[model samples]
Target: MSEKRDMSRSRKLFITDKLMRLLLVGAASTSVLVVCLIFLFLFREAGPFALNPGLGKLLDSQWIPVSFQEEHFGVGPLLAGSALVTALAMLVTVPISVLVSIYIAEIAHPTEREFLKPFIEILASIPSVVLGFFGLLVVAPLIKTTFGLSTGLTALTGALLLSLMAIPTIISLSEDALVSVPYALKNASLALGASHLQTIFRVTLPAALPGIVAAVMLGIGRVIGETMAVLMVTGNSAILTASPLSSVRTMTATIAAEMGEVPFGSVHYQALFWIGIILLVITFFLNIIAQRVLKKYGMMK
Candidate 1:
């Protein structure tokens, strides 16, 4: 009788497990379906403009879209500016983020770390619009005076603001990764007479490289997708420029600024969809690379 009861209980538990798995799969399928639908909608809207003869015009630096007259759909300059902003922002963010992470995870005293971590979290929660406004009022003027640019809304200003926005993400992720490093490794290094710094550099950091890389990837994505803050500070000039001081417009800003003005079913409108597709592709690529790096790190350990 006891054996029969045990078998019945086991059967019930197995059925419950199968039901849970089915529910999880159903949720995942719904998410995938939603993403597919969005992509399909964007492609449908953007396809006509992408196929137009004037689509070649999008390669030019100047963006002048007229509703009645022949429309110019040049997105190249905007795309280039966006890339430059994200790249420069990363350059600025990476060093500071790594250092901050080091301080938070490995170096700081317990009391200080507790205090600092909350402040950092608070910084992360501040609205991007507030930052943007601050940049416009304070940073832009300072930049204008220092650089002697007529307008403060330049690529450098945008990049600076973006770096500020990205730093918290990098710091948070890197700190978590650093904290996950095995305690045994640190003790072993110390047992051999290595200093804390030596152990961190030689052991902890290398072990946490996957997490750091993932943080950077996430930072890049945030910078690339940012719209309002960049739009407010970037002078909104669609120009291809290698000069950091020059005024520029990023792809996200362009879409935000122009979408309402462009007529529906027009080539100009569809070109915006092309820009969306480009962003989608870039984000997808970064996520894939980040996932692979994380997987490699997991397997290595």
Candidate 2:
């Protein structure tokens, strides 16, 4: 009688486990389905323009779509602007974020870590529009006066504001990554006569490199997708230039600023959809690269 009861219990547990596994699989599949639907919608909407616009014209630098007689839909300027702003933002964010992470993870006392962690979380919670307003009202004027530029609305202004927004993400994730390094490895380094800073540089940081790369990639993704702050302070000029002082517009800002004005089914509307496709492609690749790095480094299975 006891053996029969035990067998029945085992069977019931197995059934329950199988059901849970099926439920989890369904949940995972739903996310993939949603992403596929979004890509389908974008391609469907942009198909007309993508087919009609000759490749050479589409790649041109000019982007005047509102002109009645001559409407151009070149994406070169928007892509350049996005690249410039994102690159500058990363330059400002990466070093400061890594240093802050190192201090918080390896150097800060428990009490200080508690305070700093919450402060960084609060910084991340602040609304993007509010930051944009701050940029326009405060940072913009400072830049204009300090640089003696005609206007504060330039790529540098946008990059600075985007960096402010991205710092919290980079710092928090990077600190977590640094903290995850094994205490054993650190102790071993110290036993070998390495100083605390040396252990962090040579032992902990190497083990945590994958996570740091992932953090930076996530920060770049965040900055690339940001719209309100960029639109508010980037001067909205669709001009191709590498100089940080030059006014520029990004792909995200283009969609946000002009989507409402463009007529439905028009070529301009279709072009905006094409831009969405481009953004989706960029984000997808970034995530894939980050995941590959994590997998290669044995940080993720």
Candidate 3:
């Protein structure tokens, strides 16, 4: 009777394990399907962008999409705007976030770290639209007054706002990476007559490099995809300018500002989808690089 009972229990557990495995596989498959569908849809809408609008126009700086006579879909301005804002934002976000993470992970007392972590998370939880409003009302005026500019809506303003948004992400992930560095390694460095700061810079930070790189990439990705905040404060001008003080419109901003008013199935509409495809490709590459670094570090299989 006991032997029969044991055999029955084993059979039931095996069946349950198989059922759970199938459910996990199905969920993962569904996620992949959703992503593929999105890519396909964007590609379908953007197919005519090349032929009708002509890829030749992309090299031109003029982007008069809604002009009365001869509308041009020059993408140079949008790409430049995005690159400038994203680069500037990353320049500000990376150093500040990494420094703060290092302080939190290595220097701060436990209670202080506990207090700071919650604030970082809270900042992250704040909605993008609210930040947009703050930038529009507060930061914009400050920039305009300080720079003696006609208006405050410029690439610098958008980059500052985006940096504010990206900081929490970079800090939280980087703090975790820094903290994950083994205590034994630090002890060994200390025993070798190295000071705390030296050990951190030479040993801990290097060991945490992969994770830090991943965090920075993710932060850059966030800055690239941001639309509402940049749209609200960037003056929405699609102009080719190298100056950070100049008003500009990013690809995401262009899509947000124009998509609703644009007529569906028009060449202009497909052009917006093409912008989405560009953003999708950039973000995809960033994620791939991040994952590769993590995998090399044995953080992922």
- RMSD to the true structure for each prediction, in A, is 3.7, 3.4, 2.7
Tell me which of candidates 1 and 2 scores higher on lDDT. 2
Give the whole-model CA lDDT for all candidates, comma-separated: 0.88, 0.91, 0.92
Tens-digit lDDT track for model 2 on 203-279?
99889999999989988988999999999999999998999998999999999999999889888999888888888
- Give me the runs in candidate 2 sitting further than 4 Å from their true place: 1-27
TM-score of each: 0.88, 0.90, 0.92
Question: Can you write out model 3's per-residue Cα lDDT over 1-301, one digit (the tens) per residue?
Answer: 9999999999999999999999999998998999999999999988877886676766666888888788888788899999999998998999999999999999999999889999888989889989999999999999999999999999999999999999999999888889888899999999999999999999999999899999999999989999999999999888888898999999999999999999999988988898899899999999999989988997652
Native-referenced Cα lDDT, model 2: 0.91
What residue runs in model 1 are displaced by over 4 Å at the alpha carbon?
1-25, 54-57, 67-70, 299-301
Clashing residue pairs in candidate 3 are none
What would the per-residue lDDT of candidate 1 be over residues 1-301, giving only the tens digit for each residue?
Answer: 9999999999999999999999999998998899999899999998776556646766765677764765567778888899989988999999999988998899999999999988888877889899999999999999999988789999999999999899988999889889888899889999999999999899889889888998899889889999988989999888778888888899999999989887798777888888888898888888888878877777223
TM-score of 2: 0.90
- The best candidate in terms of TM-score: 3
The superposed Cα distance between candidate 3 and the true structure at residue 232, in angstroms, equals 0.3
